[model samples]
Target: MMAPFSHTATGKKAAMALRSQLAQGAKFLLGLWMAGVIVAMFVIIPQYEGLGDAGRIIIMHVPTAWVTSLAFVVSGVFSALYLFRRRVSDDASAVAAAEVGFLFCILATATGAIFAQIVWGVFWNWDPRETSILVLLLIYAAYFALRSAIDDDNRKRRLGAVYNLFAAVTMPFLLFVAPRLADSSLHPNCAFIQGSQCDGITLELSGARIGLLGDSKLELKSLERQGDLVVADVNVTRPGYQVENHRPSFDLASGKPADRPEFDGEQFMLAVEQVDLATGTARLNIEAPGSGLLGNSRTLLTFFASMIGFTALFVWLYRLRAQLLMGEEWLAQRERTYGFPS
Candidate 1:
């Protein structure tokens, strides 16, 4: 009986040692993988057409933002689980995820500011997307503050779990829905993606068809095909600005806008989407800076790779933090029960 017990203990120790070795290997590989992703973000990706080298920040910025949302989702789920099962481990996990999420959120905001300064010539203009992210950071900050304020561990966990769930419920609206709902947002999705704020308006040259794009009135004056390119004469009128005849051009062969003329005294550009010379019709759009950046295959791939790396990093961080918290809780419980020094 003693020999069998000894063998069983030895086998368990061996298994534990193996798992530790495997975890260390995985962590080392993740570090190397993230290093490669950082290198690729700058060296492998091509310069964006409108944004140039400044577009590289999107590889980091978008991923951090995505990981922020994912972390919050994990926190909310664990918070709900703790409420249902009354498990201290679940509470620890929830706290760990929220802390990680908050860190990622700050990174996302910082990178976004850098991108904004390069593209929009300002660090922050309080755009809808920017404002929403700021709000999210504050909500999570309050979550941590609430946890620190409570003296009783049980009450803190219960109250924090409830607050975390509420905060998580608001995450989707603040990050995705609210920003898209704002028509005045200069976000990339508003300009490039279909069914957003700047979907481009169709106008006929002879029918006096005029449409409003943002605060500007646009009317197609003429459409002409010049060799391999199609050009459109658009009459643009802003409320406090002079009426200007903006000639935006498109490439017939490439099926893309060739010349995107900047709006007068503004960073926004006028993009000609389609021009039908035979029917005297044209589609005009207002493109914000950094619009259509992900259209490039290289940029898209690097961006996705960065996202995956950041998400994996978040998972590692969450696990480590949860274990640390659980350990502290165990030590505290032992001290309270048997007067053991914590």
Candidate 2:
């Protein structure tokens, strides 16, 4: 026979006290970390002059991506634990992580689109990286929808674990390996987007080049025969444009040399070499892009701190769940052995 709610006051109080302790511990740490994030936003970031407008997006985008990745990983682990221990809390944690992962993934995709607009000139470029991430979002959405469709707890946990494991395996392949198979329309083929290559010079754009200053001169052959340095003569059919090899060329509008007003290493300067946009041909150069506050060290530290704090909170919750399960099992055994009133 089921007892009245009032009959369980003692048990209820103990549960409430345990919950209060967990909540207090989590809330205090979470509140402190959130305060840090706010301070980083208003105080720390604005102090950097170079970040300007794009700096704000980093506060949003990077954390979201990190959390999204972390959440999915945690969900997969919890899903596997559910299959082993048959614990209800493990299933709950899996569900909670999945939900949070979905939310963070949404933020990641949206903020990434915003960043791409500012950096790459287009909001949605259908780049391979972007496409892979979108597919991951859809795949998790389907995972959640499947969970909702099931009513039985055991069956739900089993099926969800299977899917989560499959996703965990496939995600690495999609995010890490799949993008390398083809030429990227967006950012240059770097190590993160492309597979590793040997030490021999790896030029990304074979037919396209960009110079910091001056008009790009187009294709020509090397005049020097088998030597350390080769001189390539570029003919300028276009009027009013000067074409000189190795030496700095002048711009008609501005009297200053057309090359960058900074340091001139052979490799660095060579990257921004002769291009003929008219003929749609040129060679590639490997040079670092301009710097901004978004890439600063201090900003990255604060971002990482917030993410670590968030992960710690989840870790604490996981521990709390284990304690609660132990308490529940102990109480069940006591009731059975003592023949306590049900």
Candidate 3:
């Protein structure tokens, strides 16, 4: 006959094992859904060419926005569950969703900024959409900061739950509802599904249109319609190396010293022009200070800053939830060894 304590232990272990399985299953499904979302964004949607006409912005922007909204919704629900049930699993789920939400928010902001640069002639102008999204990001950022400031688990969980609920309530108003009623702006109010009556635009892409067949002139017109400008009649010259006023040939094509032709740096130049009407002229002066022309190092700084910020966030989350994640793993091991439930 089995002892009563042993029976109770077995039941508890079984319950925990079920919960772990449920969580893993949920995570797996979410991952698969996200993968399908990526395919839709990159492959299925872009085939229309109208979406591609926006230049990858639509894919990045719309999906990130969807993920951001869904993630916060998940976070809020889990927060409420944690508050009521006081379960560490609920808290972990909420925090995980929040982190993913934050990532999507940042991506949405970046893609929006890039689109603004192409369409609005600036990266950020504090338009209704831009300002609201910025505020939303800041609010969630404060949620994380507040969590870090609190040392006690109970306090952190309670405070985070309250903040999450508040943020979730305001999100719809800030992101969707308010944008439509507020003002006339260049930003597209795409969140409202029913009231958006703008005609859907389409772009036709074919082999013949882009000079894969028939005529080069037809291809130029198609390229112009697609917001592309072709460069023609380009003249390039490489500067010559001088030794005591004697000039030596430095081939620009080969990027090396060649004896075929003697070229002088002062007399060498390239005059380039584009044949497309939809494009603007660009002149690159390599000697200009703080110039963003051609190649510049500013983008590298932006990459490193984002990397460090997210790395710090990851370290903070891992340390905060170490015991919970590790404990869940240990419980699973014990269950597998003993059977019945774990």
Candidate 4:
């Protein structure tokens, strides 16, 4: 036999207390997240290939993307649980995750648009990735619309769970499969894609490159000697990162800094306090024009902090959403004692 309504309502209050206590950790995590965001934006290295400083936007953009994916997955899992158990609490959790996921999707879209404007010279180009994101946004909108249109709570929950499941089913296809199927896309080629040309580098935790002011941070891999001029094939890694290298005519025997040739092209002047050829590096007393806020060796710290901090933020947001859902269910149950309908 089903439990009495009064008894069930009391149980809901107990569950809410437990959830509220657990959610306190999420609040702490959110605090850490905001602080980390500030540091990522102002005190970290700009991660651009060519667009100079605007590359700092990736700190927000990439994290939002990751969080969006995570939210939807959580929603899907809870929706399945709700379907199996037919619990109001489980349904609320599914809804909470979906709503939070949608918000992150919006953040990801907005950040991507800003980054696109900086590099692609346009916003909303409807590239394969952009199209996929748009599709996901539309599906989420439809799901909410469906829920709002329904009058009965039981019907709404059942339909919403089904819709959430459908959305989850489409997610991997829209986010991953469809983008790859497209023959042409403005999106840069992945370095890890076997048998594909690598026009860009991967942003991963394991790999790193370091450099000082006005230094050859990385070699032009296709560089070749053409009798007189050393042909330097600089990869146009969009919004290029790190120091810009000029094709210098001088070589190792050209007396190093004393015989350094003039860079006729563009330059980011970091005041040369000293250039040590013996160590094959230079020390700058001034800042690199487009470098991010740390402006010194501290820029290295931004790299690890941003990745870890953003990930923590995503976890906190998902937890907070789950807690909010539990609170919502508890309030509804409490009101039912006064003949309030769910």
Candidate 5:
């Protein structure tokens, strides 16, 4: 009987050791994969059409934003499980995921600020997207603060889970719906997708076709060919401001917007999409800085790779943190029950 028990114990130890080794090996591979992603972001990806080298940061920024959302979703799910099952492990997982989400949210904000400074000439404009992300950060910050303030473990977990669920409910609205609903947003969505907020308007040189681009009004005055470029004279008018004629040109050779003029009193520029010199007609659109990013295949692929790497990193971090929290909880419970050091 003693010999059989010894053999069983040895088998259990071997299995645990193998699992530990496999986890370490996976972590090592993840590190290498992320390193390759970083290299590809700079070396393999081409410069974006409007954003240039600065656009490479999207590989980091967008992925972090995605991971932030994903982490929050995981936290919400675990929180719900904890509520239903009343399990300490579920509570630990929820808290771990929320902490990870908060960290990634900060990363997203930092990367976004860097991109904004290069493209929009300001690091901290109160754009809709920026404001929404700020609100999200604050919401999660409050969740952690709530956890720290509570004295009892059971009450803390219960209240924290409830608060986390509410916070998760706000995430989608803050991240996606709100920004798109704001007309004054400088985010560029029309470049890649049709029927977005800033879709270009067609105008004939008759000056009769006036359209709104954000808060500014635009009308085409003239269309003419200048060498290899098709130039359009557009009248831009903002509320409480006089009309101004701005010449936005498109390069016929490259089939791209060339001389884009900034909208009156706004950072967004006017881009000429199409021009018909004979009919004196043109398509004019408002373009925020860094528009048409990810149009390149290499850049798009690298961005996706970065997203996958960040997601895997999040999973690893979440599991490690959850285990640590579980151990801490176990020790605390032991001390409480025994009235002595765990």
Candidate 6:
């Protein structure tokens, strides 16, 4: 029969071997997932009107935010389990999720700031959505501080559970409710309201439609103030339609619409008029008959790609954290058994 020490050593060796195998599998899966993410960036993301190249950033930024919220949810759920079962492993799971979630929250905020800078021409505006996300980060950070302040394991776990439960209660209100309290927000939200009506509006030159495809005549004249007026006459074979003066006007091509129709004259004359008016000249795009554009399914692909990639990455990190916590517990137990520091 095996001695007690010998049996214990064998069990440890078996556990380590199993862990090594799992780690290798995780590494392989992560590599494959990353490959797909790259493919989405290069081959799948599409250029749709105003959201052309810059739209690529949308995938990463949104995912980071989503992952943050998901992490908090996980932390809360694990905290609840720890309270109900009083398991040390459950407490470890809750902490791991909270820490990783906080990291994801920071990433989401930073990425969003970068995107906002590019699109809105500013960074760190106190937009309603921004405020909510910022508050969430603070809450998660506080959870960590709370955990650190307590040295007793049982007490810490109990208090942590209660704190996380309170924190979870606030998430829906802060993230979903608070932002929508304003009349309008730069943030995106999907509302399923009863009796909602769409505000009918014409699509602009820089909206949902794709690029202008046609021949154009360009005339540029230099002005005295080192500025110039450009008049371009473009003909589109197929035009998008808009109701102007209650009449369906076919825009074979279109440029940025003026606050009002700035010109009802020749393109060159309008450009000259714009120069004197000190208003920028608008390029004239004349659509022929039926050429408003739509996307080529690339936008959908990009959405899925970014969503899947970010979710996979978040799961990987969360799992890794949990595993490390488990390893720490194992080492602590081993130290006690061996009567030595590991």
Computed on alpha carbons, the lDDT of every model, listed in order, comes to 0.88, 0.57, 0.53, 0.61, 0.86, 0.59
Evaluation by lDDT, superior candidate among 1 and 6 = 1
Measured over all alpha carbons after superposition, the RMSD of each candidate to the real structure, in angstroms, is 2.6, 11.8, 17.4, 11.2, 3.3, 13.1
TM-score of each: 0.90, 0.57, 0.49, 0.62, 0.87, 0.63
Off by over 4 Å in 4: 1-26, 46-49, 189-304, 340-342
> Order the candidates by TM-score, highest first — what do you get?
1, 5, 6, 4, 2, 3
For model 3, residues 82-199, the per-residue Cα lDDT tens digits are 8999887777777777877788889889998887776556899887778888999999999899988998877898899989989888888877766656433446553224223122
lDDT of each residue in 1-342, candidate 6, tens digit only? 669989999999999999999978977887887687667766676653443565566556667777778888888999999989998888888888888888988888887787667655678879887888899889878998998899886798899999998998888788767776743344433211111111111122233222231222222222223223223232222223231121112222332322222122211111211222233232333221111112245655665666776777777788788889889888988998999987
For candidate 4, lDDT tens digit of each residue in 1-342? Answer: 456987899999999999988778767776876787677576556544345667566556666777788788989998999999998878888888888889989988998788677666788889888989999999999999999999888999999999999998998788767776754454532311321222222111122323221222433323334443333322222134544453332232342212222222323322222323333333222122222323234444553455566666666666667788688767776788767765
Cα lDDT tens digits, model 2, 1-342, are 456666688789999999999988878978788788868866775543322466456566656767777777888898889889988777777767777777777887898787677656578978786888889988988888887799875687789888987776666665656655533233333411224310112112333232222233333332221222223333322124454344222233432224322123211233323333335333333222212233456676776776676566555654555566556756776987999934
Which 10 consecutive positions of candidate 4 have the poorest summed lDDT?
197-206
Candidate number that wins on lDDT, 3 or 4: 4
Maximum-TM-score candidate:
1
Q: Show where candidate 2 strays beyond 4 Å.
A: 1-26, 46-51, 180-182, 185-295, 310-342
TM-score of 5: 0.87
- Residue 289 displacement in candidate 6 (angstroms): 28
Over 196-312, each residue of candidate 5 has an lDDT whose tens digit, in order, gives 555578887666577876677887777778899988888888778898889999898988888988866667888898777777778888877767777778888887888889999
Which segments of model 5 are wrong by more than 4 Å? 1-22, 49-52, 189-195, 204-208, 264-266, 275-281
Q: Candidate 5's C-alpha lDDT?
A: 0.86
Please give the TM-score that candidate 2 achieves against the real structure: 0.57
